[model samples]
Target chain A: MTHSDQISDSDQMPRSAWLCEYLARLEDEQVMAQHGDARILAPAHRLELDPEGWATAAKVAAAMGLRHAGLWADCLDDSALAAEDRAIRMQACLEHAGDYLVLETQVPMLRPVLASQASIYPGVDRLERHAHDLTGLELTSQPDGRRWTRHQAWPEDRFPLRGDFPLAGEPVGRAPADADYPFGRVQGTGVYEIPVGPVHAGIIEPGHFRFHAMGEDVLQLEERLGYVHKGIEKLAVGRDPAGLARLAGRVSGDSTVAHAWAACQAMERATDCIVPARAQALRGLMAERERVANHLGDIGAVCNDVGFAFAHLQCGRLRERWQRRSQALFGHRLMMDAVIPGGVAVDLCDKVVEELREDHAQLKSEIVPIFDVVADHPSLDDRLMTTGVLSEADARQLGCTGYVGKASGLAFDVRRDSPYAPYDGLAMDGAILAEGDVAARVRVRMAEIGNALRWMDRLLKSLPDGPICAQLPEAEAGAMGLGIIEGWRGEILSFIRFGPDGRIARYFPRDPSWFTWPALERLIHGNIVPDFPVCNKSVNGSYSGQDL
Target chain B: MFRILKKSFQTGVVTETPPDVADAEFERIGIELRRRIDVRFSRSLAIRQVDAGSCNACELEIQALNNAYHDVARFGVHFVASPRHADALLVTGPVSRHMEAALRRTWRATPSPKFVIAAGDCACTGGEFGASYASCGAVEKVIPVDAKIPGCPPSPLELLQGLLHVLRG
Candidate 1:
C-alpha cells in the first residue's frame, strides 16, 4: 500500500514519487504554455490505482519515452449502465474498488498512474499476464509468475476475469487429470520435449505447444492456452447490445468483422451510438471483405504448409471465390452477425454493390500473376525466405499485433492507430516489414491482400445511402465503453460493461490472439520440427481467438 | 498399347469399376463375410469434430462438409488428427463437463467399427450450451452416438444428410 502512499486521487505519492510528481506537472505544463487540457482521459485516472498501482503505471510510461498502449484489468459494474453522465460517469469516473480492480492505460498525462508496464516495458509481459490470468489481479513484480491465461479451461480457483463469474457455458467444476499444468519449461543437453497440442491436426482451435528441442533447434517454446474456453466472458454477462453483437461474432469464427466491429464499438461507445455514414461505409466494406478473405486464405495456408500444392489449390480457389462473394453479399459465409448494435446487419444491395465491384476487380486482377507464382518459386523461395524469424526487436518485445506486427516492423493499426468509423475517411495503408521472416510473413500477407483489395475498391465506390440500423438508445446502466477493432488478427480490444437493465455487466474481448500467442513461442526458434506447419501458418493465431 | 489402356477402362471411357460393391451377394457370407467385405472396402472416415455445446450452428454445418457443396472429401469424410486418427466421432456439442474428458479421450481413441456423428441441436440436446454450467447435456453422455445431425448448425445439406447417416449404420 505504498504506491503514492494513498491520498486516493488527484496527487498522492510513491509509484516512484507519483511518477516524479506527474512528470514534473507535465514538464511544468510544458513550460507555461499549458500542455493542453493537462492530458488525463484514459481509464479515467485508472480509477485511482491499487493492485500495485500497475507498477506505478509503468514508471510513468518509462519516465516519458512514452509509446505504451495496453495494460488491462477491469470489472467496473455499478449496475453497469442505462445512463444517468453514463451511470454517473462510470460510477463516478470508472468504478475502482466495489467489484475490485481497474488499471488500464494509454498515458497522455500520467493518466491515473498505475504503471508497471512490466517493469518499464518488456512489452508489458504478456499484457500483465493476461490481467493476472483473467482477473484475480495481483501483479506485484510479474516476469512470469506462470499461468498465462489459465488453461485446463477454468477451475484452478476460478477467475475468468471476476465480477461473480458464471456467464454460463457451464463447468465451474472438474480439475485434477494430473492437475499441475502451470506451463514454464526449457532445460538442457538435447533439450528434449514435445507436447504439440491441446489436441491438433487442423480444423483449428485448442492449444498447448511446449517444444524445448535441440535436435530441431527450438530450445524454448511454451504455450498452453485456455482449451476452448466458451464462457465467452461469462456468456457476455447479461447480454443485449444485440446480445453483445451475437457474442462478438462468436469471438473468433475467423474474426467475424473483427469480432462484430469490436462488439459494435463497445455497444456504440456505451450507448451514445451513432453509426450511419452508410453504416460506416458498410462497416468498411465488411472489414475489407474480412481482410481479403483472411489474407487470401492465410497466403494459401502458408503455402500449403510448405509443400506448395499449387499455392494450395490456388489459395483454395481464391478462398472459394471470396466465400461465394460473401454468400452473394452478406447473408453469412463467415460474415456472421454482420456488424450489429445500431448499424449494419445487411445492406450492400445495389446488386450486391455491383457484385462487390466485380469481385474486387477479379481479386485485384488475379493476385498479380498468383503472387508471382508465390514470389518466384525455387521451392517457394527455399521454404519461405529464412523461415520463421520475428525480430523487429522480437516484434516489439512480443506485443506482436496484426499481420504479425506488420511483418515484424510493428507499425500498429487499429485502423491507423485508433481512428474508428469508416477508417476515418479511408486512405489507411499499413503493410510494413523488417523481415521478421516466413517470407516477411508472406509479404505481410500479400501486402495485406493488396491493402484489402484497395480498401474494397474505395469502400465500394464510396458507399452511402442511409439506415442499415440505428435504434440504440438504451444502454446506460453503469456505462464504461472502449472498443478498438482493426482485427484480421490485430488490435481487437473491446471492454464494454453496461448491466442493471441494459444488461452486459462486463464483456472483455482482447484477442490479437493475446499478443500473437506469445509471438508463436518466439518465432519457433531456428525452425525445424517439420517447420511447425509452415511456422504455424505464419502466425495464424486465433485458437477461437485465444479461447475467448 | 496396353490394349488401348485396357479398352479405355472397359469401354466406359477412362475409369468405371466403382459400382460393383453394392451387394454382390453380401460377398459370399463366409469368414466373417470376408472380414466385413474387407473392412467395408477399406473405409476412410477419420473425423473427431467435438464442439459439444454449439451454436456454431453445427460448426458451420460441419464447415459445410468441407466446402464445395457437401464434399466431405468426396464422401470419405476425413477431418481427423487425434481421436487417434479416427474412423468417426464427429460430436459437435451439448456434452459440457468441459467436453467430458475431451469427449472421453475422443471415444477411447477410435479404431474399430467406430462411428459417432451427433452433429447439431447442440450435439442432439444441450444445444445452446444446454442451460450451461458448461454442459454435459448430450452426445449420448460422452461417447456412443452413431448419428444425429439436427439443425441450428445443421445444413451443409444437413451435413451431407448426416454424413450419409453415419455411412448407413
Candidate 2:
C-alpha cells in the first residue's frame, strides 16, 4: 500500500514540475515501467497503464496529494483479443492542485480484477464497487464489497456494462426484497438502531439511513443509496454527441443545465471546435441563474427543516419566481436540454436581457432582507450554528467542493481556478468560508448566490454579438475529451471517448455529491437524531446524481 | 416578524380556489375525476408518495403542490407519512430495480381502498429511461396505476388534477 519509498530522490521537484519530469522518468525500466502509454489531455494527462503499473500509478498520484475524482470502466472489444485475454478497461481519475490525471489498465474478463485504491482514497469505496457491479471487474482488496450500484437487478455473473449483456434484463418472477441490506452495528449498553426510509415522509428521493444511536445522540449514520439508479452510464454508450448531451442533462434533473454544458464542452473539445463568444456568455448566464435558483431553494429548505416556515415560504416564492424567468427566457423551468453539443439551443435578445437585469435587481432587494431575518432569528441560529461540523481536514480528505467544501474551508472553485470559456477573466473573491458547520454552509450558499447574481449582470451587460452555435465536425474514431464545470452543487467532471460514427465509447459524469455525501456521514457523527434532517439538508447531495 | 405580517396581508391569498387552479390543462381531468370519487372520500384525500426511482424533478413539483402558491392542503388534499395512513400512492420515476419491491410493499401496506397515481412521464411510461437491466419502466408495470400524469416533471396543478381524478374512482 505504501509506494513512497519507490519514489526516489528524482521525485523531489516542485509539485507543478514534478508530474511531467516524473512521468518522463517513468519510462526508465526501474519505476512502474510496464508497457504503458502516456498522453497529455487538455485538462489532464492520461496514462494507459499495464495491469502491473495501474495500482502504482494511482498510488503515485495519491501520494502527491492528488484527490480521487472518479473511477469507471470501458469495455474492450473481445474480437481483437484471444478468448482468454478478452478484458475490460478500467479507468481511475485523480485530481491535483487543479489538474486531473486519468490512469487506466486492462483486466481480463475471465478473472477481471484490479487492486483497490480505496486503501489510499477512502472515497473510491463506492466508485470501485460501481465499476465492479456494472463491468464485472472486481477489485483485489475492496473493503466494503456490499453492492453499490447493483441492487440485485442482475444475477451475480451477468454484467450489464458488457457489450453482450442485454439492456432488458431477464427477471425471474420478482426482484428479491432489498430489506436485508447489512448495516454496520454498534453493540453497547445504550445503543439502539433506527432505520428510516427507502420510502420517506416528505416527497424526496428514496434512500435508507441507518442510525446507531445512544438515546438521542448519534454514534454513526450510514446511508444506503442507489434506489434511484437507472443505469445512466450503461445507457450512455453508443449515443452520438447530441444524444449523449440529452442523456447527460437527465443525469440529475436539477443539474440539467450544468451536466449538459459539461457534456457539450467535452464533445466540442473532442471535435476540436470552439463555440462563439456569445454562446459562451449564454452558457455562463444560464449556469449562474441555475446556481442562484438552487441556492435560494436550499437556503429556504434549511430554514424549513428548523421550523422557520416564513423564510422557507419566502425563499420558495423567490425560487419559483426565478425559475419562471428561466422558463420565459430559456423555454423550460429547469432549463433542461437547453445546452446542445455545439452550443446553446436558444439566443437572448436586447429587450430580454434588459428585463432580466431589472428582475435580477428586484430579486436582490427582496432576498437580502429575507436573509437578514433568517440570520438574526435567535431560534434558527441556535439550531443551525454549530451543528454538523465537518472539519477542514475531513473536507480535504473527501475532496468536498461547492458550498460544502467552501463552507468547510476548501478554497477550490473551477470558475476561478480552472476557468473555462466564459469565466476566463471573472473575479471570484470573498465566496469562501472555513467554519465547516451548518450555519457556515448556509452562509456560503447565500454568499455564492450574491456572487452569481453579480456575475450574471456583468455577463449580460457585455454580451457579445455573434453566432450562438458552431458547426462541429464529426469526431475522429478514438477521440477523447474532458469537461469540468463548477456546477451549483460543486465541480462536475465529465470524461468522454468517441467511437465510430460519432458514437460514445464511454462517458462518466462525476457529480460533486460523490464527495459531499461522504462528508455528510462524517459530519453527522455525535449530533442528535433530530438534527439529522437539517445536516442532510445542508449537504443536500442529489440522490439521483449519486445513484447514477 | 412585523415585515412578514405586513407582507402576508399584502400578498392577500396567494393560494388559488380549488376549481380555478391554473396549470397545464388539468381542469378537464379534474372535473372527470371529481365525478368518479365517492362523496365520503371526496371531502378529504391523503397522499403517501413513494419515489420508486424518480430523478426528483417530479418530487420538486409535488413539494410545490404544498407551497404557498399552490397549496393543495387547502383543498383537503395532504401528504401523509405512512402508506397505511395514505388513501393513494403518488408514485414517481421509471421504477428502479431496487425500489420495485419497496413500491410493492408500500402498496401492500396501504388498506384495501388504496389506489396508485403515476406522476411524471417516467412514472407513466418510463420516459427516456425505459425498461432496462436496472429499471422496470413505469409505475404500473409493478403495481396497478389508477391515474397517470405525463410530463418530464408534471406541473404542480397537473398533479392536483391527477389526484382528483384518482379520488373519483
The digit string of per-residue lDDT tens for model 2 on A198-303 reads: 8888889999899999999999999988889998887888787888988898888888889999888877777777788888889889988888888998899999
Instruction: For candidate 2, write residues B34-143 as lDDT tens digits.
Output: 45443647756788998888887888778877777666665667799999888888999999998988899999999978778999999999997888888999998999
DockQ of 1: 0.06
Worst 10 residues of 1 chain A by lDDT: A87-96
lDDT of 1 by residue, A209-285 (tens): 87878886777777776555555676677777886787687666677777778778767766666677887778777
Model 2, A531: alpha-carbon shift in Å? 0.8
The candidate maximizing DockQ is: 2
Q: Report clashes for each candidate as comma-separated counts.
A: 37, 2
Candidate 1 RMSD to the real structure: 25.0
